[model samples]
Target: MALAKGTRLGPYEILSFIGAGGMGDVYRAWDTRLERDVAIKVLAERLACEPRSLARFRTEAKSIAALSHPNILSIYDAELEHPPLFLVTELLEGVTLRQQIGRSAIPWRRAVQIGSEVADGLATAHDARIIHRDLKPENIFVTARGAIKILDFGLARFKPAFQGKPGSRATTVSEGGSLMGTVGYLAPEQARGETVTAATDIFSLGCVLYEMVSGHRAFNLASPASTLAAILNDDPRPVADYVADVPEELDRWIGHCLRKDEKARPQSARDLGLVLRDLLAEPTAHGRTGAEFESLAVLPFFTSASSPDAEYLADGITETLINQFAQLQHLRVIARSTVFRHKGKDADPIELGRELAVSAVLTGRIFQRGDVLVIAAELINVRDGLHLWGQQYKRPLTDIFAIEEDISREISERLRVRFAPREQSRLVKRYTESPKAYQLYLKGRFLWNKRAIESMRQALRYFEQAVEEDASYARAYAGLADCTSMLAIYGALDPRLGGKRARAAQEMALQIDPDLSEAYASRGFSLLLFDWKFREAESVLRHAVHLNSGDAPAHQWLGFALGLTGQLEEARGAMRIAQQLDPFSASINTTAVFPVYWAHLFEEAIEGFRAAVELHPGYWMAHYYMGLTYAHKGEFGQAILALRHAAEIGDSIWRYSGLGYVYAQAGRPQQARSVLKKLDELGRHQYVPLIYSAAVYAGLGETDQAVEWLRRAAEQRDWMIAWLHVDPIWDSIRSDPRLQGIRVDLGPKP
Candidate 1:
């Protein structure tokens, strides 16, 4: 399909032949309508004649249009309606990389620059779910202005996903296979004709990068078949082996991209680009590069507003940024519970970063006047206290989403932490388009974090109003589910309500956004406590944590579900992650120690509990749990002291009944009876879970009374009944027929 000079197709005149390839023939052409010089890729005869191939080519050409990166050759149009099918693209004035690299091996830094540019183009396409099946030096052009442009994107599919020629390793795959990549640069999975992903392009890019630095093919052998085998089974020689003064880190980083297991490769092109760019920045940044994971702490945004609603706006900014940053797999964002602890203390960003042991700290001040918001943000490098990035944004409140997106993008660019597609979507995901609904949701979250009974009620009201304002808001529904679950957990509401109100809210949230991990976490809580579906609870909780690994509460809940079902080691592991993410949370720390306490590792549990207690001395929940752990350790005097401290802090059923149970465990029958009597009088006026009384009865060795009370507790749908299958307090009446019957009625089958 060679076109002669002066041949006209549609409005474009083929002025001269440029080159030829398997997919098409390139020609210098005149665009009559746009009155400009352009490059035209005239399709091969087989592709032009086949309707299916033509349609597929047209569809993929549109996908390529989404990638308008400077490093990517711009496609002007896919001319399909004309007799001859062709693609119009930007003309280039530089030699192919194959010609340029033929002179000599490129310098390491220059090679890194080229690789970074290629990666930036790949990132844009990959983020749009487009895969470049073939990438080689000949397909990369180095312009006269020193810029690189990727050629023939989405054109590899003209033959197969790898197109090879028998006995010729010029640039194609073997003849017998349907594979489509150039033989030497084919990724292992592509060589095997397996399904491709964004990682496949990463492997090909690594081969190109290897060639740039070493001035030779990454895996050239005696034949294309031999090269394919090498790609599948062998590691390329390190760039340093072939070139002088190439850093070992650069070699290792390339090796990560060339890994045979695609899973081991960099998950996203943008992430790898950032790593390479950082390596390039090492000389000026005091010779530093990111370690395993870059850690960051986003301190709570300071505010000038006095009203609670206006303050909620500031809290929203801090929380939104933290959630977005946490989604990056290569970044460890400090949890909200930890960062919010220094909210009003005016902590220095440098000091906070050092205290949290993170690479950087992000501090912000937010001021809202009427409908306008003014935000000043700064990202400081912890080591030298240099401002990595800083910006001030003044925008109408209605455009908060755009403002946040710009801030997030700028920060990630400065920090060299780019998000994968999934993470990018999560970062810019707008739960509600309406600014009013967003404000209501933020107020709801602020109230929910307070964790008080009355505040939770207030949070519920706000969440309901948020959804009323925008019925399609998934986050508002997630908030409803979380608030309702907390009320049920604290015995402030009937456990039966979890199956009704909480269940509906969770289902609605999932319906709107099926990947909402927090909603899944709330559903797991209900299944564990109210439905007596222990196995289902653990499965749902596991899925929740899988969706969002940074979710401390999800990990904490999963730990409880695992510990109660006798999976002590796994429970301890989950809790450890929760504790790591939320270091300053008293409840998280105490529950993080729960699996150890339940495993009867008394000394270990004692150490864990004491550490948590010391960190949060005023948290009564920690003191109460320490008492139970001491009782199990047979330290009766210390147990009594802990329980007394718990009772002195709060006189609720948790602390009061817990004291009675510990008193009986210590053999103080008279004191235990007095506490039980006090509970009995109080139960007459309020809704007290009989399970609390049952706990004291079990400790006192009153078998019949405990069994009767357990039956009543099961009838009332009390949450504590779920622990019957695991709690050691019930070991005394382990074989009682009445207790077994109650367990059958209340617990899941082991």
Candidate 2:
């Protein structure tokens, strides 16, 4: 029975018929819960109504659902309690491999690539003792972006193994049954009605690979009867006979798969796939193969949307892609902070590549046209300035996931950068299936990067909306946590309130996805600030870096934690890696001076802050730190100027705190009192950080009040309380009993 459009089956609305097959009729459908397109295959009545077939279908479906390989069509849902038994899978867009080959014979190298991908998917299935008894090109799909997906993973088990005549379909009996398979490609034992194993599928794959390059069936004869006889008694003509230029190794590989003795053939699909992939491992004519391709720079993608909102969208895309590429093993992808500084510059790709000292440069343009998002990318070689590979994708906005996956994988393939299987599996790993949630998260990140009071607040709202849309979105939760904690760090919110919210969100994020590296980094920062647990924070931050060495923030946090413990050399090493990973980030460049300033290297720290200000002149973070360093060096004039600039540029509590501290240190006690009066007015409307009062008091030689305020700062979980050991401002009252007690209560920074 054909289900008409709008027909509902278990929350899936049938949109239209996709195709009909012996197993069932496939329909394009919408999954109401996920709000995404899906393909539903309703079993044919013959198989649906048969008790034996129905029982086996459940077993096979359950097994197939457990296999998660990229090359296999994903099974989302399986219903079998009643009639109309069906399975749901991700909808694909492309021709079948049969259609691709029918149009023309593929080159031997291309054929090898296809075969290797197929065996990779099969290897996962075989590991679970679930073989695709019917391994043929007709059951293989070639996605639009050239990905190979194995189709009909377990459908062959839904009925009698076989039934037909010579020159027609084959036949097999019921009871003590095996998975269904085609006769022309069957192994010798399977053809003799004997026990079939994974080796049987290997033999079938040999036949398919043979035809891919030779354009002829491996065992065709005068009749199907003769074909079966040949399978039992003979081997087909050597593949080299059909194509003289075919590699000799491929002929031997096929010969091994067709061995009459089952044990003599390759024992597993995994081994066969590795063998096939190894054939393509030789260096390509135009590009580097291994370490050479590791040095890459993914420049900020340009956008043509002509609006501030679209500008954020473009930057979000570039950053997301950089993060994705950074996880690939052996690839030293340029971090977003560094590459984004070059955005909108009209420099040549090759010139930028040479300046960045990278082997290749990936430049891209994103054009938004209503519902369609056009993304064009080109990878150019630095050594020769040749276009190694390029592609333009004009797809619906919802296809962003597919587009990114294709671009990353294609580049990895083009560059011949090999990754272990586990790493490869994570290359396109998604944090959320909801496109709406993902977009909102991107916007949240874009706004959060602005590092202003209002922008951070606005970013929190977007992140909250994203989590509401998809509660399982760990990355969104991580964003919400980071934003919340930053508000406290900047003194916009009370530390108690902000830390509570941040910890709650961070816990949820980790619970949802434990391996999420950013969430771990966020937790590490909270531990240092709110709990003053430097050792625990350092270990957690190190694990975060271990999870993703490309996560620059992880390295930066590790440096900060190490610096507080007086591990100067180790702290500088971590900061250097962070700088190497994200060299141009004003935040990074400024924070990197923390150890230098703490070690009393005032001149060096001032130079570092100056470098950061030159990179981003308006960045208040650099100016604020610069003022602190100059005051410690007794350069009161320059110190006051930096603090004034910081106050003018930013709208945060730090805007005036540093200035007030400098005034007291310069013996302008009256001006310092006026600044404290201003703070008193501001306190009526917000939670003012106690550190501001402590710093000013310490500078004024009021040791008792300074220590009392320092105690209060520690009690309130102030963001800067950990600086007690490093800030020279605190040294004046180091002998105060209350300050010593506060330091002991804070549990060891040094």
Candidate 3:
């Protein structure tokens, strides 16, 4: 069906021929119904006669229609059942990449940007469980605006385990036994008739990128067979050979992508996109190109407002910007916890930068008047206290997101940071259209960061309100899960019920946005604290860390999981990473005490907790843990004083239990009995971790009573029981035969 100008196909009037391909002919057309220009791709009659070919064509239309991404070509409609079947897509004014790459080399920066955009599109498609098996220059378009758009998913397939390694080499042919994809860009596994995964697309993109930068195909030969052989066995010429100024890092990245073993290639298209963007961001000085160690800290925005709500808004802006910067994998952004330590302190930018070990510091002053917000921010070079970039944004409250985007973009420009397309979108991505919902979400996050029982409850209210305003807000759901689980862990809610709610909220978050690393980390916490599923918790937490290396909480939770499983040394490594990511975070700093305490290094645990106290003397958890470490070392007097101080700061069953245990150990029977009575009374009125009661009894040397409480704790599924293998508090009860049975039941099942 070669449609001449003025031909009508249903509601579309063909105006001119665009081009023809093996599968179809493309015609520029006008969609009368929508009154818009569209490109119509009509399947060739000869190919349409074959059921398998028609099916593949229809699949392409449907696959593309299901996707919504800037880099992906947009599909409007598909006519499958009617004769002269065709697909409608947005009319793009651009040349196919093949034409754009015609016999000339593209600048390295432009090439990287094009490749990064393509990788971002591939990553989106993979997330939708669709694999673009045909990735080549001919299938990509470079719009007049310089944006890259991927075309032709004609060889796309559905693979739910799309992110996993490719299937075995034996399963290459489609159901109809047709070989798919082009030869030149075929991954080595694909060339060998082996199954392909996202890595296949990555390899293809690498070939395309190499051609773009070098003005030659990466693995072309005199014959198709020879080209396939090159793809399967030979390495392409180093990119630097063609482009003298090409960075060694870029060559290494492309080489990794072109590896013969698909398993050895970049496993994630998103990660590859980040690497490409990093290459563009890497500074070149004196003819040297390498990663610039440009770390930055975002100081909490200063506000002179008397209203607490105004202060919250200022804090939220700082945090949101910090989060936005953290998403740029090429940028080293100090965590909010570490940076907020400078809140209200008039610290010099260079000194603060030295404290945070960042190359630069971002400081801002926020003011609100009626419905308007005024923010003045400046980026300062830490080495010399020199201002690098500064801006003042005065906008309506509803335009807060726009302000953030403008700030982020300007900062990235000044810092020489290049973000992948996805990252660029995420830096300004608004999760809710409603400003109220966004505000509530911000407030929830602010409260949640306080990490107190009452604050968590308040955060829960705000999070619920945020979701009520915007049901699709994934971050709000993640916050909901975090608060719900923390309530249970802190004994503010029933363990069983809190765990169930937390899991449900976490599932909702993942369903809305599976890429949210915070949701996965929160789920890992629920798994560990509620279900006591140590192995599954470890798996989820590790995946969270893999997704976002800068996620301090994920690393912290992974360390917690490792500590519970008795992997002391590995736990220490994870904790160290967490501490580096969040140097001043009291919670993260206190995490080190656990592995040291479990390893029975009482002195180290005490020292670690004391150091945490010095960093945050008001952090009750630090004082509480320090008390436990002291008790373990038989310093009962110091333990009692520390525990009492912790109780004064924030009273909890753990504090009472620690106090009781120390008193008992110090031969103060009356005080120990009184503390036990108080715990009993509190248990009747509020939720209490049975572990606390058991600990008190164990400290009193009451074997039968301790075993009884331990049994109850097991029946109730107390989360602390998961640490039975390594908990130093359980050492006294371990020798008791009945306690051994309880320990066995709590241990990982064979």
Q: What TM-score against the true fold does each predicted structure earn?
A: 0.61, 0.62, 0.61
User: Residue 421 of model 1: what lDDT?
Assistant: 63
lDDT of 3 by residue, 545-617 (tens): 8777788889999988887877778889999998988888999999767898888999888889999999999
Candidate 1 similarity to native, TM-score: 0.61
lDDT of 1 at 356: 94
Residue by residue across 496-539, what tens digits does model 1's lDDT show?
Answer: 76557889998899999999888999999888887777778888
- Which of the numbered candidates is closest to the native, going by highest TM-score? 2
CA lDDT of each prediction against the hidden true structure: 0.80, 0.81, 0.82
Q: What would the per-residue lDDT of candidate 2 be over residues 465-542, giving only the tens digit for each residue?
A: 999999999999999999999999989998988899999999999999999999999999998888778888888899
On a 0 to 1 TM-score scale, where does candidate 2 land against the true structure? 0.62
Give candidate 1's whole-model lDDT: 0.80
Candidate 3 wrongly placed segments (more than 4 Å): 1-285, 288-293, 306-308, 418-421, 735-750
Residue 514 lDDT (model 2):
93
